[model samples]
Target chain A: MEPQLNLVRLKTMYEKMVLIRKFEERIIELVQEQGRIPGMQILANGQEAVAVGIIESLNAEDVIVSNHRSHGHLLAKGADPKYLMAEIMGKSGGVNKGKSGTLHLAVPEVNALMTSTVVGAGPPLAAGAAFAQQYRDEPNITVVFFGDGAAAEGSVHEAMNLAALWKLPLLFVCENNCWAGAQSYSQHCSIGNIAQRGIAYDMPGEYVDGNDVEKVYDLAVSMTDYCRKGKGPALIEAKTYRMRGHGENDHQHYVDKEELVFWTKKCPIGNLKEKMLKEGLITEDELQVVETVSKAIVDEAVAFADESPFPYAEEALDDVWVK
Target chain B: MAQLSFGQAVNNALDLAMSMDESIFLAGEGIGVSIHYDPNMPSHGLLEKYGPKRVKDTPVSEAAIAGLAVGASCMGLRPVVEIMFLPFITLATDMLVNHAGKLRYLSGGKSTFPLTVRVKAGVNFAAGCQHSHNLEAWLAHSPGLKVVFPSTPEDAKGLLLSAIFDPNPVIVIEEMGLYWGKGEVPEGDYRVPIGKARIAMPGKDCTLVCYGGATVTALEAAAILSKENIFLEIIDLRSLVPLDRDCLLNSVKKTGRLVVLHDATKFGGFGAEIAAIVAEDAFKFLKAPIKRVAAPDIPVPFSPTQEKFYKPSARMVVDAVKSITG
Candidate 1:
């Protein structure tokens, strides 16, 4: 059965995802040409649904903490593409004023906390935000996005235990793209499923088809609602696959060609487009308009980044601490 | 005036701050419980009397505890985080160093993290190396963080209340040895401002600088030295980061000698920083090269004999004073 989602909101979510895909592709091209981008880690291929689905379900007041692969997360959370692009370019006009680079973009207006380059650092920070929200008696929830590989980190385990025990309003979204850098999930994780870790903490856990955008959005919305209602923390492990290398320079030597092909067949964007067309939720012309608009927005953001000035030399000491 | 323990002084300061300013609250692991201290005990009972919302208990995640305190402080909450032990601060260093310390300067002065992290230093009984290390020197190196180590109950109450109200991240290092040590605390609320060192005792032979539990040791050593007609000037360095350079320099100039004491390891301790500051600023007045009497570069041992050797005592301070004043 189809879940009831508002058509306008669904289209907005689709647009956001497409824009993130285009923006990341542009970033990858620039990185390949220049051999450097301020924030090097890019989650271009594997984890769009995890960011788009969860962020789309959040209110502007709710906060988010993103991991190293945070471009899609930041973009989906409604950061200005121009500033984000400028940030990746290390320009003064960027969010974080270029001090954070790509790895640590933070926009306070949207309530997005600073991202961490460490794999499992965001969970504890998110738990802290949850504590703050609970303390203030605000109906805000903290959503943290991590990778399947980060599930092995002691910090993540500690964060989960704390979130559950304190009944903190937090959501742990694991984007299980089946690899951490070059190492496959089987080599790194003893347990086959990352979602099972949630049971140990006594928090509700679920696995979703990450490529199915509608399913991811539905689950995220429900989970966010549950967390807001003070039911405590929950875990949603989105089973996805990386279509690109671990980063811009990676050749993915350990990944099999067949496995790569298998994931490409399950492309999240492609599946969403097909679903929209079959269900008559949107016409081809309307979808074409979204693609065109997203491309233009991405193109404008890239131009803005290229044209933007590098941060002033004195800015290096700025934004390291709040005055 | 009323007699109060170091822990009681801290609790009184927190209660005074919380009552004075509605924004101030306590958050930490086991803060609300009587397990570590006592629920009816000064600080723990304040939470119960105030409410769970004001005196909150957090899960055993120091990073989250510290990070949340930093975030909340940025948003106008004066959060006093009770880190059970000084060694456990390593878990919260990222937030303390990167976020709390740098947040004010990073935002180009747009934000201030008014957070007070209360932790106990010194080896009380046999808690072993991991739990007994005095690591204030590691934190004092960070320019943005304010380090406070109070010796007496009055100083603990005043300095902690001041730290709670200060507009920066302050590390209040309490000594487990002084937790039960009683002193005359002021009847009403008061605050000992950061960046000021107190002259615990006055003399002309040598200037003895110390903080936390070692301040007691230094004063005791000064008394011993007085019996020998060695006039020792004891300076309690209440604040370490914004160190009272003027007081140290003036005292060193008058006495013509200096001896620094701490419970931390000798190398790279806060004593080193103080010694360097004196050498750089007041080297001309030195009778002898400044001496730093501190723990050897070893962990606090569990054995009573070894632990006594690991921590600096009055004898060591007296010997150092004698060497510096020779």
Candidate 2:
């Protein structure tokens, strides 16, 4: 009595998750070996389902303002991994001509407002975008991505308050990854869940198991629809964990080993693969093909990045103003 | 031409811009709420005209308001936001400086932020330390931002129009004290170009350069100096970011003396930048050492007597000019 699933779309989602995992794994290798990426790389190893689920629900015209840990979101939003890799490697061929590097990846062509390195900065930007969309009576919605750490920021509260007050079409997606760097959620947040904060803004808040990509996708679709209907903003707390350290530079001594083992067992990609196989939505061979395609994409991206050239020293002075 | 106060001129400009460009809307504290606040604050009565969607009366969240403006601008809407007091802009510097100012550059010129942030500068009727601040120096120092501090009612109307049309983010600094000052304003379709300075008066002895709240002080000092036959040229630098160095240097070159004036603190103020520009670029043209008439390096005191001493008045400008030209 399982619900019918589109095998083609399920395969696509699986491939994207694979691509994200492989892309992050390659970036870690690059950072370790050649020091290619600028700044610390915050890999979305286990949080791929949250980004893939939410972004899949959005139209190409809808805007997404991402936070520091945004690689998975960028990839899910149709950013070519080649340019992203080149940008991470600080090459001229990158999306921002390597001016932004890892923390500030941007692709305006797909309504991807540049990623903000500052904690809790994206929500206000999202609020602004949503306000514009609503003012113009455009049916587009804006989704702002933040972490458990950003839930405590006053900017987030102010932005949510404005979104509610104005009845803007905005979706606040909080990826509760259990830790803000070495600090655990128990220490950083008083509330057990970030979704509960949405009540303060008078918006519908929901929680989903981030490891279950299907549940996340269903919830994201509902929330995005709710906001787009002019019912004001909505909040979603996807309970998840950063399987890796906060950033590549973090030693991660604060997290208990038992907690890590528990989350690792609830791996999103693995869970999805098991579900699909159980339902006969995808065979092991089909899943292997998806994995192979993802690996090829990441490999091609790395090759393109390695072949890409660095920008000229004088190029730094460019792009500051528009005539 | 019709006579209008500085605040009326600003209201006229907003009304004109909104009439022409439906994309231009107002968002700020006290923008919607009418009655207690007077016409001197341009945002009064706007809510009735434009309704809630166009005239967004926001909560007292400076950061969110600024961020909303910048975000809307990026989406191709011209948002004119108000930061009630200049000092309160500190709460929103992250959005104004980091996001709004750098979005164009960081996005590799793919995005444009056409945001007009209207802030009132200088002391406002003993509004106290928190409210009374003319922090043009802080805004001018930021790259990717255009800072305009208009003194006259005419300039207020024209410059605000220009700031709205500007593709980048602009901080329009209005002087609270100049709100009621009346002057002839062009009836319609006016724009005072940014990055330009106006020569208020021509003279041969020394040049008095100032802008914002201090422009009135320079004009007042010009009148006194005229009576004394000092013949001090007065330069009102309407735009601070571009600095109007050519206009400033040319005036100094003609008069052979320079006296920069501002309401900001003397140390590390905008006057220092103007002074350095003259010292470096127009040093050969100077007849005497460059002097700056500015507020002392201290917070605006609450007591009127202490504030009077803290603020740089027309007397200070006159004294600085006498010391330099004597």
Candidate 3:
């Protein structure tokens, strides 16, 4: 039997996954409507399990730095979907006052840190956050989420080298989502898995089926614990895929139809629900109740976002300096 | 008060600041190690004093070094990082410009990022074009960043302390030529406010404005002009980003003449900003056309003979002042 979390916490995780799916689906509608979210939207529709699993093993203090595709991770870290919705819509009530559209949302209150828009810019920032934790002799670690395309960036290599050399408490989580803005991993990388690149830094790392939350969580527990124990940085390649285009703007004319169908069958939420039911972990009514709760939460989030006001035009000149 | 070299004053400021705030730490390439180590530079003896954790020595990664500062600053630590030289700041500009300089603004004034980038400017040691070019103009041009270049050992200590504690990203340019130059610096906790300028020498005929090691050039020119009974008031702009326009305007209003000088190339140099400020704000006070003394628009040469020609000399400043004050 798979070692499972308590039923309540496991069901909460299921609820969060559904909530993220609904939140993303709502955002797609907002983007389609056009004037609500002015900028480009990058949604993580099929990668909910990876974020939920990693966040399950993390503490409140673990600093998280993410990339452009960060809505799922933000939600997993307990970000209020309402402020996040307001933020993406350029409203004043956002966590960041709408200064960071969807691309750079930083909910510092939850230790979510900043979300960098640049492709490979997050690793170095994570290294620095990790360095600070280690310097303070604190047990808390830093987790940076990057994609496979970032693996090819020299900044990522430099960050890895520094983290290993200094024995910083850092976890390099590479969410290998198959494609980086429409360019497949095969085209961007010379190797099959990015986690193997850790060998050059003399750091231990491996890959896992990111679609399987239990498997990813089992590894995340060990990897984050390894970093928290002051054993230096660790790398993990969460092999996953986004069911949608890189951004809502693109059409997936380049994707293979058969491959998409095969992956869609491995849907994380559906698979987890099937397992839970097979083992009698949850009843169909309980699962349906969770979905209903998630939909209500997303409904409130959208209402809050719609009611929020846009920031003043002159507010742009503020916040550059302190005193 | 204590007499200290410009280099020692920097070391003193860092030492004092670290003693006061445990959050302040140092990280750079060969920080206290032999490669970038010299007993006189700002980071010397820091490793032995703070130990390995606080004074981190890292691999040759400029981007990571700056990114480290940006990350650490957000984590309630005031990280004082080194970019080695002005030219190498290019390697680190992405972190400074994209993250460090913008994160706070992006944070909607809700967060504070306190970090300092210590860089050497105003050519010395014949380190060639890559190592010797003064790139203060590049840093000063980037918004949300404060830039400072100390002309005196006193200002060196005060400005560095202020830069470290300032609740924003600041670039402290330690003029390489003035490292060993001696002046009186306060013992501890002295802070020269950012966005402030100091009048290096008081006079009446002309306002000679300059920064970094060029302050010495301006001073030398002042002495020469004084001998000929043509007094030139000197304005050493300690900070650049906040560009002390009031200081320049008031001095020019009194002197009725202006001469901007620096060791950087004339085109698009920070001196151009000073010239523009005077022309825009203090133009009515001018009795003659404003003059500028700066290096010619060319790469700083590798050869010492060529390097001397590349820098603006004391004679250049004197001539520049005479053109406006004659």
- Specify the highest-DockQ model's number: 2
Docking class of 2: medium
* TM, every model: 0.92, 0.97, 0.97
Candidate 2 displacement at residue B271 in angstroms: 0.5
Scored against the native two-chain complex, candidate 3 gets a DockQ of 0.75
Ranking by DockQ: 2, 3, 1
Task: Show the lowest summed lDDT stretch of 10 residues, model 3 chain A.
Answer: A1-10
Residue range A215-265, candidate 3, lDDT tens digits:
888799999999988889999999988889989988789999898998898
- Candidate 3 lDDT over residue span B130-222, tens digit each: 988888898888888999998999999999999999989999998887888788888869999988999999999999899889998888888
Report the interface RMSD that candidate 2 achieves against the true structure, in angstroms: 0.9
Ranking by lDDT: 2, 3, 1
| DockQ of candidate 2 against the true complex | 0.77
What does candidate 2's lDDT look like per residue over B80-111, in tens digits? 99998899999999999899888788777788
Candidate 1, B1-326: lDDT as tens digits: 88888778888888888889887888788788757665224475786678988888887888878877876775567889888889999998877877777655543354567889998787756999889888887898776888999998999999998898888889999887777777899966798989899999999999999988888888889889999899988999899978899999999999989999888888888888889988998999988988989889988889888987888889988887877565
Superposed model 3: Cα runs more than 4 Å off? A1-4, B36-38
